[model samples]
Target chain A: MDFAPTPEQQALREKVVRFARDHLGARAAEHDRDATFDESGWKACADFGVLGWPIKKEYGGGGLDPLTAIMAYEALGEGCVDNGLVFAINNHLFACAVYIADHGTEEQRRRWLPALCDGSLVGAHALSEPETGSDMLSLTTTAVRDGDGYVLNGTKKFISNGPRADLFVVFARTGGDDVAPQRALSAFVVPADTPGLTARDIPKAGLRGTLMGEITFDGCVLGEDQRLGAEGAGYQLFTSTMEWERGFMFASQVGVMSRLTDRCAAYAARRRQFGRPIGSFQSVSHRIADMRVRLELARLMLYKVGWLRSRGRLAMQEASMLKLYVSEGLKTTALDAMQIHGARGYTEELGIEREVRDVLAGTIYGGTSDIQRSIIAGLMGLPTAA
Target chain B: MTDDIAKTVRSFIGEHVQDGEPGDDHDIFATGSVSSLFAVQLVMWVERTFGIAVHPTDLDIENFRTVNHVVRFVESRRAAAAPA
Candidate 1:
């Protein structure tokens, strides 16, 4: 198999890098300090065609293939230092807008995709309630049939982009027996302005620039057209979207790892102790080496996932494997960078500490590390209860 | 074709499931014959063995609850895929 990127892919990466360096993540420290969402940075990404990179061009998107999109996201992470903003864009594209594009009817796509592609509507995924984090099948959210629509009632906690989203793809139980839990759920594309829907920002230790929050839907009414796919298809919809979320969403994190490696290597070479550069010492050099190793491994797995998706193949196993590797690998690399930089790394101004904090949440979100492990094992013909 | 599909499905069930001699119409989920993970495995097997891609809308338990059901589901999918 050919491992080299085409000229077009390379050009796209270069263009994204240049654009991100010039336009995105300006004053990231201030946004992180205040735990605020950077609307300007988001608008810049939307304008740069990042929000619709994988969507069809007819819907006001770039319609790039899966591999090209991964390259662009990797370049975005390498060029733009704002991890939170990148994450917000990923959540919006993969978790929310993808539902409409992949599962929505022609009318639904016509209604939502253009607005979502442009900055007219921000998107968020409504899953992971306070009680059900990884236990998605047991979600207590209820959507009962009304006259011609459905009324949704539930609380979705730790939702990325919750505070600023204009549209939310909500997963709620519709029908099925307790024994057959997988068939009980359904997906809906609900507007955030629905009468009974409330979004409140929850301040967190990291990824603060992307507003995370709890959204309470109190008898929120949605029309019949809002339903994605068929009734009792929410779990399937979620499982299908998860390959993107778990695999391609972490493409940016791979870029972050590469950046951290470069930064740490430069710092080690520049910083001298006992009349010689710290690179002279094996301890410091070994950490740098490990950082490089993790970056390479993460990139390989991530690109493999992209290649698989580009071919319209099922990558459930690879996606789970990549999700577990990249997130945990980034955390380790970030910690290594912190230790190599010493005091400067711990300081807020250098942003090494922020990187550590930001990457720490990677293992927890987009399905936890534990959940990824379970998924990997289960896919391997090993029976698991999860 | 039905017999072949049923044999393939039964072998998968026997490999993962234990402590029960389930009938052809047994509720695989309710009877604890298979967990959700096995359900996914079964889907993958059906797709690979029969060369039929099961859409997300067709992932209902009614189609996968038993070996007999799986055979019927595969036959229907093949029929649908065939030209008039």
Candidate 2:
């Protein structure tokens, strides 16, 4: 149960902090206001080897282990004020790239990994549709067998990086109504240049730098070689990938929570209130203290999931708990910062209001707070379902 | 072994699963009583109760469509794991 960071992890954290502070999120407010994806920051991240942190060296990646990757991401979150940039990186690496690296065949890995690592390609996961969010089996996306390939027809909504992604990890139904819906699903890797694919930007209030969009696949044909895993294996692949998504994806948000707390506490101390510092007030100080507690516990939970992953053990329950905790914790802390900073927080100048907007998406993505609660309860042998 | 596996699976189903009936092999997925979330729990239960791990390849809905299928999957895994 050691909580101390290794020397290498400490150094990596420092390096990431330095890089992120110097190179990323310079015009975060401008980008967020315009709902624009920061291409320059992304290129900087690629140059810094951020995209390849968890991938293997053979695949043109840094090959960092799960724990080290989490540490580096935490540093990035702390140093980079652009939550949207971090969210984009998270979506690319965990949600899309890792899918191929973990489940793709050797041929598939060789085909896309180098480009993915070098930032020549951007990746997006196409799972959610107009009709589905968490109910994956109910998705109406279909891939019909045609000769030696499949033709896909579907519309994926609320996709991160969709507008600019060069590649997509798409989940669609391949089996007929006779098969169970869960068993009917299959995943495919589709390039954006495919003849029948279109991605339209869907402007949103937060995570604007990630470029949320809707992807439409109309008779988009992919060869049999592009299918990930075997037929009817999409459910398993998605569930396992979600283990990574729910566990490691939010480690950066834990870092964001820590950063927000420090900012709030400093504001509470330095800002003059009725007589002296606002920190002298019990209500304000108590909220700051609560944020500290949440940060500590959230870090512990995040690290526990990383540790479990490192040991090749199952972390289904822990991942759901961590995802739920860190997400909600960040939201609470962000709102607290807003309240503590008063008008300054509410104003866009201080970026405190932006933090609130950014943190609100946490409880909704990956899996909703309600969905996580259901997962936790179901794991506890309760009859809960999401 | 089969009886024990069935009993354990039945016990879990009766306790945690909504609208589950004992001594029946009704298609849980077809009925919508077993959701993806419940399916994960069911897999974990099979692993813990049978002392065998359910690999990703073993996660096909066919393996968990019914208690009878689960018992068979567990038996096959246990058999494969046993010493020659």
Show what share of the native A-B interface contacts model 2 retains.
0.34
Model 1: lDDT of residue A19: 93
10 residues in a row with least lDDT, candidate 1 chain A:
A175-184
Per-residue lDDT of A112 in model 2 = 97
Candidate 2, CAPRI quality class derived from DockQ: acceptable
Q: Runs in model 1 with CA error above 4 Å?
A: A176-179, B17-33, B46-84
Model 2, runs deviating above 4 Å? B1-3, B13-33, B50-84
DockQ of each: 0.38, 0.38
TM-score of chain B of each: 0.87, 0.88
lDDT of 1 by residue, A1-386 (tens): 98889999999999998998899888899889998888999989988889999999988888998889999999999998989899899999989988899889989998999999987788999998999999888899999899999999999999999998999999999874553576678999999899999988898989989999999999998899999988887876788778889988899999999889999999999999999999989999999998998888898898998887787766777888999999999999999999998998899869999999899999999889998998878876777885
lDDT of each residue in A151-269, candidate 2, tens digit only: 99999999999998999999999988887666789999999999999999998868877898999999998899999988887887898779888988898899899889999888888
Full-model lDDT, candidate 2: 0.87
Q: Report lDDT (Cα) of residue A326, candidate 2.
A: 93
TM-score of chain A of each: 0.98, 0.98
lDDT of 1 by residue, B1-84 (tens): 677778777777767776454667876766544565677677777888889876645656678878789889999989998999
